[model samples]
Target: MKKFVLVGVVAVCVIIAALIGTRMLTPPPAELDLARSKTSVNGTYLASIEPETEPVSVGPVHNWVLTLASADSTPAAGVTIEVDGGMPDHGHGLPTEPQVSRELGDGRYLVEGVRFNMGGWWELTFQIESDVGSDSVTFNLML
Candidate 1:
Protein backbone atom coordinates (compact mmCIF):
# COMPACT_ATOMS: atom_id res chain seq x y z
CA MET A 1 0.00 0.00 0.00
CA LYS A 2 2.81 2.44 0.84
CA LYS A 3 4.51 1.76 -2.49
CA PHE A 4 1.32 2.48 -4.38
CA VAL A 5 0.86 5.79 -2.56
CA LEU A 6 4.39 6.90 -3.36
CA VAL A 7 3.95 6.11 -7.02
CA GLY A 8 0.72 8.09 -7.13
CA VAL A 9 2.40 11.13 -5.64
CA VAL A 10 5.22 11.00 -8.16
CA ALA A 11 2.72 10.73 -11.02
CA VAL A 12 0.82 13.77 -9.82
CA CYS A 13 4.01 15.78 -9.56
CA VAL A 14 5.01 14.83 -13.06
CA ILE A 15 1.62 15.91 -14.39
CA ILE A 16 1.89 19.25 -12.65
CA ALA A 17 5.35 19.83 -14.04
CA ALA A 18 4.21 19.01 -17.52
CA LEU A 19 1.31 21.44 -17.32
CA ILE A 20 3.54 24.26 -16.17
CA GLY A 21 6.10 23.46 -18.81
CA THR A 22 3.51 23.58 -21.56
CA ARG A 23 2.27 26.97 -20.45
CA MET A 24 5.77 28.43 -20.33
CA LEU A 25 6.68 27.04 -23.70
CA THR A 26 3.68 28.42 -25.54
CA PRO A 27 3.52 32.11 -24.80
CA PRO A 28 1.33 34.61 -26.60
CA PRO A 29 2.25 35.24 -30.21
CA ALA A 30 5.48 37.14 -30.53
CA GLU A 31 3.95 39.62 -32.97
CA LEU A 32 0.69 40.02 -31.14
CA ASP A 33 -0.35 43.58 -31.81
CA LEU A 34 -1.62 45.12 -28.57
CA ALA A 35 -2.61 48.40 -30.08
CA ARG A 36 -5.68 50.09 -28.68
CA SER A 37 -6.67 51.36 -32.13
CA LYS A 38 -6.94 49.30 -35.28
CA THR A 39 -8.77 49.21 -38.55
CA SER A 40 -11.76 46.96 -39.06
CA VAL A 41 -11.26 43.68 -40.88
CA ASN A 42 -13.08 44.93 -43.97
CA GLY A 43 -11.43 48.32 -43.90
CA THR A 44 -14.79 50.01 -43.48
CA TYR A 45 -14.03 51.74 -40.20
CA LEU A 46 -11.44 52.43 -37.58
CA ALA A 47 -12.11 51.42 -33.99
CA SER A 48 -10.35 52.16 -30.76
CA ILE A 49 -10.90 51.03 -27.16
CA GLU A 50 -10.04 52.57 -23.84
CA PRO A 51 -10.59 50.86 -20.53
CA GLU A 52 -12.33 53.01 -17.96
CA THR A 53 -10.01 51.75 -15.25
CA GLU A 54 -6.29 52.12 -15.53
CA PRO A 55 -4.38 48.85 -15.33
CA VAL A 56 -7.28 46.40 -15.70
CA SER A 57 -7.37 43.55 -13.27
CA VAL A 58 -8.96 40.15 -13.11
CA GLY A 59 -12.38 39.90 -11.38
CA PRO A 60 -14.91 42.67 -10.90
CA VAL A 61 -16.77 44.02 -13.90
CA HIS A 62 -15.58 47.19 -15.59
CA ASN A 63 -16.45 49.49 -18.45
CA TRP A 64 -14.74 50.55 -21.68
CA VAL A 65 -15.10 53.34 -24.17
CA LEU A 66 -15.19 52.48 -27.85
CA THR A 67 -14.60 55.08 -30.49
CA LEU A 68 -15.52 54.60 -34.09
CA ALA A 69 -14.31 56.58 -37.04
CA SER A 70 -14.28 56.32 -40.76
CA ALA A 71 -11.23 55.35 -42.75
CA ASP A 72 -10.78 59.00 -43.60
CA SER A 73 -10.66 60.02 -39.89
CA THR A 74 -14.23 61.22 -39.65
CA PRO A 75 -16.15 60.28 -36.50
CA ALA A 76 -18.78 57.72 -37.30
CA ALA A 77 -21.97 58.41 -35.37
CA GLY A 78 -25.31 56.67 -35.02
CA VAL A 79 -23.66 53.29 -35.26
CA THR A 80 -24.59 50.00 -33.66
CA ILE A 81 -21.77 48.01 -32.11
CA GLU A 82 -21.68 44.50 -30.69
CA VAL A 83 -19.03 43.14 -28.39
CA ASP A 84 -17.75 39.56 -28.15
CA GLY A 85 -14.53 38.12 -26.86
CA GLY A 86 -12.68 35.49 -24.85
CA MET A 87 -9.30 33.97 -24.25
CA PRO A 88 -8.30 32.47 -27.55
CA ASP A 89 -5.88 30.06 -25.95
CA HIS A 90 -8.36 28.88 -23.31
CA GLY A 91 -11.15 28.27 -25.78
CA HIS A 92 -13.81 29.92 -23.62
CA GLY A 93 -15.96 33.02 -23.72
CA LEU A 94 -15.87 35.93 -21.29
CA PRO A 95 -17.49 35.51 -17.89
CA THR A 96 -19.72 38.52 -18.55
CA GLU A 97 -21.75 39.47 -21.57
CA PRO A 98 -20.51 42.96 -22.25
CA GLN A 99 -22.60 45.28 -24.37
CA VAL A 100 -22.69 48.82 -25.68
CA SER A 101 -24.76 50.35 -22.94
CA ARG A 102 -24.90 53.89 -24.31
CA GLU A 103 -23.38 56.29 -26.72
CA LEU A 104 -21.14 59.00 -25.29
CA GLY A 105 -21.47 61.08 -28.44
CA ASP A 106 -18.81 62.00 -30.99
CA GLY A 107 -18.50 58.37 -32.11
CA ARG A 108 -17.81 57.06 -28.63
CA TYR A 109 -19.90 54.28 -27.06
CA LEU A 110 -19.94 53.03 -23.52
CA VAL A 111 -19.15 49.35 -23.08
CA GLU A 112 -20.34 47.84 -19.83
CA GLY A 113 -19.72 44.59 -17.94
CA VAL A 114 -16.20 43.91 -19.21
CA ARG A 115 -14.43 41.39 -17.04
CA PHE A 116 -11.28 39.33 -17.22
CA ASN A 117 -11.36 36.21 -15.14
CA MET A 118 -7.85 34.97 -15.78
CA GLY A 119 -4.48 36.34 -16.82
CA GLY A 120 -3.76 35.34 -20.37
CA TRP A 121 -4.21 36.37 -23.95
CA TRP A 122 -7.71 37.80 -24.38
CA GLU A 123 -9.46 39.07 -27.46
CA LEU A 124 -12.20 41.70 -27.64
CA THR A 125 -14.00 41.89 -30.93
CA PHE A 126 -16.32 44.66 -31.97
CA GLN A 127 -18.79 44.22 -34.77
CA ILE A 128 -19.79 47.63 -36.01
CA GLU A 129 -22.61 48.61 -38.28
CA SER A 130 -23.19 52.11 -39.50
CA ASP A 131 -24.54 53.96 -42.50
CA VAL A 132 -21.16 53.71 -44.11
CA GLY A 133 -20.85 49.90 -43.79
CA SER A 134 -20.53 46.94 -41.48
CA ASP A 135 -17.17 45.77 -40.22
CA SER A 136 -15.42 44.15 -37.29
CA VAL A 137 -12.25 44.85 -35.34
CA THR A 138 -10.50 42.71 -32.74
CA PHE A 139 -8.14 43.86 -30.00
CA ASN A 140 -5.83 41.72 -27.92
CA LEU A 141 -5.20 42.20 -24.23
CA MET A 142 -2.73 40.49 -21.93
CA LEU A 143 -3.47 40.84 -18.24
Candidate 2:
Protein backbone atom coordinates (compact mmCIF):
# COMPACT_ATOMS: atom_id res chain seq x y z
CA MET A 1 0.00 0.00 0.00
CA LYS A 2 2.34 2.76 1.22
CA LYS A 3 5.32 1.11 -0.52
CA PHE A 4 3.47 1.05 -3.85
CA VAL A 5 2.64 4.76 -3.57
CA LEU A 6 6.28 5.58 -2.76
CA VAL A 7 7.56 3.57 -5.74
CA GLY A 8 5.14 5.28 -8.16
CA VAL A 9 6.12 8.74 -6.91
CA VAL A 10 9.83 7.99 -7.34
CA ALA A 11 9.27 6.70 -10.89
CA VAL A 12 7.36 9.82 -11.88
CA CYS A 13 10.12 12.07 -10.49
CA VAL A 14 12.79 10.18 -12.38
CA ILE A 15 10.88 10.44 -15.66
CA ILE A 16 10.34 14.18 -15.21
CA ALA A 17 14.00 14.71 -14.39
CA ALA A 18 15.03 12.80 -17.51
CA LEU A 19 12.76 14.95 -19.68
CA ILE A 20 14.15 18.16 -18.17
CA GLY A 21 17.73 16.99 -18.56
CA THR A 22 17.19 16.13 -22.19
CA ARG A 23 15.89 19.62 -22.91
CA MET A 24 18.77 21.29 -21.06
CA LEU A 25 21.56 19.18 -22.60
CA THR A 26 20.65 19.49 -26.30
CA PRO A 27 23.14 21.53 -28.38
CA PRO A 28 22.24 24.25 -30.83
CA PRO A 29 23.24 24.09 -34.50
CA ALA A 30 26.36 25.86 -35.69
CA GLU A 31 25.92 29.14 -37.53
CA LEU A 32 27.21 29.56 -41.10
CA ASP A 33 28.78 32.39 -43.14
CA LEU A 34 29.31 32.44 -46.90
CA ALA A 35 30.64 34.31 -49.96
CA ARG A 36 29.63 33.70 -53.54
CA SER A 37 32.21 32.28 -55.96
CA LYS A 38 32.40 32.90 -59.69
CA THR A 39 34.03 30.70 -62.33
CA SER A 40 34.84 31.09 -66.03
CA VAL A 41 36.89 29.27 -68.64
CA ASN A 42 38.00 29.30 -72.28
CA GLY A 43 37.86 32.49 -74.39
CA THR A 44 34.33 33.09 -73.20
CA TYR A 45 33.67 34.07 -69.61
CA LEU A 46 30.22 34.55 -68.22
CA ALA A 47 29.45 35.84 -64.76
CA SER A 48 28.43 32.55 -63.17
CA ILE A 49 27.69 32.47 -59.46
CA GLU A 50 28.53 29.75 -56.94
CA PRO A 51 27.58 29.29 -53.30
CA GLU A 52 30.52 29.49 -50.90
CA THR A 53 31.32 29.29 -47.24
CA GLU A 54 29.64 31.92 -45.13
CA PRO A 55 31.80 34.28 -43.05
CA VAL A 56 34.77 32.84 -44.88
CA SER A 57 37.87 32.98 -42.73
CA VAL A 58 40.40 35.33 -44.32
CA GLY A 59 42.86 33.09 -46.20
CA PRO A 60 44.95 32.95 -49.34
CA VAL A 61 43.31 32.51 -52.69
CA HIS A 62 44.13 28.82 -52.83
CA ASN A 63 41.96 27.36 -55.61
CA TRP A 64 39.56 29.11 -57.95
CA VAL A 65 37.92 26.86 -60.51
CA LEU A 66 37.05 27.56 -64.14
CA THR A 67 33.92 26.14 -65.65
CA LEU A 68 34.38 24.20 -68.88
CA ALA A 69 30.92 22.73 -69.34
CA SER A 70 27.30 22.70 -68.19
CA ALA A 71 24.23 20.88 -69.32
CA ASP A 72 23.02 24.06 -71.07
CA SER A 73 26.27 26.01 -71.21
CA THR A 74 29.40 24.49 -72.72
CA PRO A 75 32.67 25.80 -74.13
CA ALA A 76 34.66 24.08 -76.85
CA ALA A 77 37.92 22.26 -76.22
CA GLY A 78 41.40 23.76 -76.87
CA VAL A 79 40.04 27.19 -76.10
CA THR A 80 42.47 29.48 -74.34
CA ILE A 81 41.60 31.44 -71.19
CA GLU A 82 43.12 34.69 -69.93
CA VAL A 83 42.39 36.41 -66.61
CA ASP A 84 43.65 39.89 -65.73
CA GLY A 85 43.04 41.62 -62.42
CA GLY A 86 45.71 41.87 -59.78
CA MET A 87 46.44 45.55 -59.30
CA PRO A 88 48.43 48.03 -61.39
CA ASP A 89 45.52 48.25 -63.80
CA HIS A 90 43.27 45.84 -61.89
CA GLY A 91 45.15 43.27 -59.84
CA HIS A 92 46.85 42.81 -56.46
CA GLY A 93 50.31 42.97 -58.11
CA LEU A 94 49.88 39.87 -60.27
CA PRO A 95 49.89 39.54 -64.05
CA THR A 96 47.21 41.43 -65.92
CA GLU A 97 46.92 38.54 -68.37
CA PRO A 98 47.35 35.06 -66.92
CA GLN A 99 46.77 31.87 -68.87
CA VAL A 100 45.30 28.43 -68.20
CA SER A 101 44.62 25.17 -70.06
CA ARG A 102 41.37 23.58 -71.17
CA GLU A 103 40.72 19.89 -70.68
CA LEU A 104 39.28 17.67 -73.42
CA GLY A 105 35.89 17.07 -71.83
CA ASP A 106 33.35 19.55 -70.55
CA GLY A 107 33.46 21.17 -67.09
CA ARG A 108 37.26 21.02 -67.27
CA TYR A 109 39.67 23.96 -67.46
CA LEU A 110 42.59 25.41 -65.59
CA VAL A 111 43.85 28.83 -64.50
CA GLU A 112 47.50 28.74 -63.60
CA GLY A 113 49.03 30.70 -60.71
CA VAL A 114 45.74 32.15 -59.50
CA ARG A 115 46.69 33.45 -56.09
CA PHE A 116 45.72 36.25 -53.72
CA ASN A 117 48.63 37.48 -51.66
CA MET A 118 46.94 39.93 -49.31
CA GLY A 119 43.57 40.24 -47.64
CA GLY A 120 41.15 42.48 -49.49
CA TRP A 121 38.47 42.41 -52.13
CA TRP A 122 39.96 41.89 -55.60
CA GLU A 123 38.57 42.23 -59.09
CA LEU A 124 38.88 39.55 -61.77
CA THR A 125 38.55 40.02 -65.52
CA PHE A 126 38.13 36.88 -67.59
CA GLN A 127 38.80 37.31 -71.30
CA ILE A 128 38.42 34.66 -73.95
CA GLU A 129 38.75 35.25 -77.69
CA SER A 130 38.84 32.38 -80.10
CA ASP A 131 38.04 31.67 -83.76
CA VAL A 132 34.57 30.87 -82.49
CA GLY A 133 33.78 34.09 -80.64
CA SER A 134 34.90 36.48 -77.93
CA ASP A 135 33.54 36.65 -74.40
CA SER A 136 34.51 38.21 -71.09
CA VAL A 137 33.32 38.45 -67.49
CA THR A 138 34.12 40.48 -64.41
CA PHE A 139 34.02 39.26 -60.82
CA ASN A 140 35.27 40.14 -57.34
CA LEU A 141 37.06 38.10 -54.69
CA MET A 142 37.31 38.65 -50.94
CA LEU A 143 40.25 37.21 -49.00
Candidate 3:
Protein backbone atom coordinates (compact mmCIF):
# COMPACT_ATOMS: atom_id res chain seq x y z
CA MET A 1 0.00 0.00 0.00
CA LYS A 2 2.83 2.42 0.82
CA LYS A 3 4.50 1.83 -2.57
CA PHE A 4 1.26 2.48 -4.48
CA VAL A 5 0.66 5.73 -2.59
CA LEU A 6 4.18 6.95 -3.29
CA VAL A 7 3.83 6.21 -6.99
CA GLY A 8 0.57 8.10 -7.21
CA VAL A 9 2.09 11.13 -5.42
CA VAL A 10 5.01 11.23 -7.82
CA ALA A 11 2.75 11.03 -10.81
CA VAL A 12 0.65 13.89 -9.51
CA CYS A 13 3.76 15.97 -8.96
CA VAL A 14 4.96 15.33 -12.50
CA ILE A 15 1.61 16.38 -13.93
CA ILE A 16 1.68 19.63 -11.99
CA ALA A 17 5.18 20.38 -13.16
CA ALA A 18 4.23 19.77 -16.77
CA LEU A 19 1.28 22.10 -16.49
CA ILE A 20 3.45 24.86 -15.03
CA GLY A 21 6.02 24.45 -17.77
CA THR A 22 3.39 24.67 -20.48
CA ARG A 23 2.02 27.88 -19.03
CA MET A 24 5.45 29.43 -18.90
CA LEU A 25 6.01 28.63 -22.59
CA THR A 26 2.77 30.23 -23.67
CA PRO A 27 3.11 33.56 -25.47
CA PRO A 28 1.28 36.63 -24.33
CA PRO A 29 -1.63 37.98 -26.35
CA ALA A 30 -0.87 40.58 -29.01
CA GLU A 31 -1.84 44.21 -28.52
CA LEU A 32 -4.41 44.82 -31.24
CA ASP A 33 -5.74 48.27 -30.40
CA LEU A 34 -2.58 50.28 -29.91
CA ALA A 35 -2.61 53.98 -30.68
CA ARG A 36 -0.94 55.18 -33.88
CA SER A 37 2.11 57.34 -33.26
CA LYS A 38 3.07 58.46 -36.74
CA THR A 39 6.52 58.68 -38.21
CA SER A 40 6.74 60.12 -41.72
CA VAL A 41 9.05 58.32 -44.16
CA ASN A 42 9.20 60.69 -47.14
CA GLY A 43 5.52 61.59 -46.94
CA THR A 44 4.63 58.81 -49.37
CA TYR A 45 3.09 56.52 -46.76
CA LEU A 46 1.96 56.78 -43.16
CA ALA A 47 3.59 54.57 -40.56
CA SER A 48 3.35 54.46 -36.82
CA ILE A 49 5.04 52.68 -33.91
CA GLU A 50 3.03 52.13 -30.77
CA PRO A 51 4.68 50.72 -27.71
CA GLU A 52 2.73 48.07 -25.86
CA THR A 53 3.02 50.21 -22.76
CA GLU A 54 3.19 53.97 -22.56
CA PRO A 55 6.09 56.04 -21.15
CA VAL A 56 8.76 53.74 -22.57
CA SER A 57 11.66 53.70 -20.13
CA VAL A 58 15.31 52.77 -20.28
CA GLY A 59 17.06 49.51 -19.34
CA PRO A 60 14.05 47.29 -19.91
CA VAL A 61 12.69 45.02 -22.66
CA HIS A 62 9.66 46.19 -24.61
CA ASN A 63 7.52 45.15 -27.52
CA TRP A 64 6.93 48.03 -29.96
CA VAL A 65 4.03 47.35 -32.29
CA LEU A 66 3.72 48.98 -35.71
CA THR A 67 0.99 50.12 -38.04
CA LEU A 68 1.61 51.10 -41.64
CA ALA A 69 -1.00 52.85 -43.69
CA SER A 70 -1.40 54.88 -46.83
CA ALA A 71 -1.94 58.63 -46.89
CA ASP A 72 -5.64 58.01 -47.28
CA SER A 73 -5.74 56.03 -44.01
CA THR A 74 -5.86 52.53 -45.43
CA PRO A 75 -4.06 49.83 -43.54
CA ALA A 76 -1.05 48.60 -45.46
CA ALA A 77 -1.73 44.94 -44.94
CA GLY A 78 0.60 42.28 -46.34
CA VAL A 79 3.49 44.68 -46.24
CA THR A 80 6.78 43.67 -44.65
CA ILE A 81 8.28 46.01 -42.08
CA GLU A 82 11.72 45.44 -40.64
CA VAL A 83 12.75 47.01 -37.31
CA ASP A 84 16.27 47.96 -36.25
CA GLY A 85 17.14 50.30 -33.42
CA GLY A 86 20.34 51.52 -31.82
CA MET A 87 21.86 54.29 -29.82
CA PRO A 88 23.45 56.65 -32.34
CA ASP A 89 25.67 58.36 -29.83
CA HIS A 90 26.81 55.09 -28.30
CA GLY A 91 27.24 53.53 -31.77
CA HIS A 92 25.61 50.20 -31.03
CA GLY A 93 22.32 48.56 -31.84
CA LEU A 94 19.85 47.06 -29.47
CA PRO A 95 21.19 44.25 -27.28
CA THR A 96 18.61 41.88 -28.76
CA GLU A 97 17.49 41.38 -32.37
CA PRO A 98 14.08 42.98 -32.45
CA GLN A 99 11.86 41.46 -35.15
CA VAL A 100 8.37 41.64 -36.50
CA SER A 101 7.30 38.31 -35.11
CA ARG A 102 3.72 38.43 -36.39
CA GLU A 103 1.21 40.47 -38.37
CA LEU A 104 -1.97 41.18 -36.49
CA GLY A 105 -3.88 42.33 -39.59
CA ASP A 106 -4.82 45.91 -40.59
CA GLY A 107 -1.25 46.94 -41.11
CA ARG A 108 -0.30 45.93 -37.58
CA TYR A 109 3.01 44.15 -36.90
CA LEU A 110 4.24 42.97 -33.54
CA VAL A 111 7.91 43.80 -32.91
CA GLU A 112 9.36 41.67 -30.16
CA GLY A 113 12.70 41.16 -28.39
CA VAL A 114 13.60 44.83 -27.92
CA ARG A 115 15.91 45.82 -25.11
CA PHE A 116 17.85 49.02 -24.52
CA ASN A 117 20.92 48.45 -22.43
CA MET A 118 21.50 52.10 -21.57
CA GLY A 119 19.61 55.36 -21.82
CA GLY A 120 20.47 58.03 -24.41
CA TRP A 121 19.46 59.03 -27.89
CA TRP A 122 18.19 55.97 -29.77
CA GLU A 123 17.17 55.84 -33.39
CA LEU A 124 14.69 53.19 -34.47
CA THR A 125 14.65 52.67 -38.20
CA PHE A 126 11.86 50.90 -39.99
CA GLN A 127 12.32 49.54 -43.50
CA ILE A 128 8.95 49.24 -45.18
CA GLU A 129 8.44 47.32 -48.40
CA SER A 130 5.46 46.04 -50.27
CA ASP A 131 3.57 46.21 -53.59
CA VAL A 132 3.03 49.91 -52.95
CA GLY A 133 6.76 50.64 -52.74
CA SER A 134 9.72 50.70 -50.40
CA ASP A 135 10.84 53.42 -48.01
CA SER A 136 12.46 53.94 -44.64
CA VAL A 137 11.58 55.93 -41.55
CA THR A 138 13.59 56.76 -38.48
CA PHE A 139 12.29 57.67 -35.05
CA ASN A 140 14.48 59.39 -32.51
CA LEU A 141 13.81 58.58 -28.88
CA MET A 142 15.54 60.19 -25.91
CA LEU A 143 15.29 57.90 -22.94
- The prediction achieving the highest lDDT against the true structure is 1
Which stretches of model 3 miss by more than 4 angstroms?
1-36
RMSD versus native structure for model 3: 14.9
| lDDT comparison, 1 vs 2, better candidate | 1
TM-score, ranked from best to worst: 1, 3, 2
* Tens digit per residue, CA lDDT, model 1, 70-123: 999899999998899998776788999999989898889999999999888999
**TM-score of each candidate structure, all chains considered together:** 0.83, 0.48, 0.69
| Candidate 2 error regions (>4 Å) | 1-61, 68-72, 87-92, 95-98, 102-104
After best superposition, candidate 1 residue 38: deviation in angstroms?
0.9
lDDT tens digits by residue: candidate 3, 14-107: 9999887775454333432233466466665788888898788877888988888877888887887788878655557878889888999988
Instruction: Identify the superior model by lDDT, candidate 1 or candidate 3.
Output: 1
- Each prediction's RMSD to truth: 4.1, 17.3, 14.9
The deviation in Å at residue 19 for candidate 1 is: 8.6
In model 2, what lDDT does residue 53 have?
A: 31
Instruction: For candidate 3, give the lDDT of residue 112.
Output: 90
Candidate 1 — which pairs collide? none
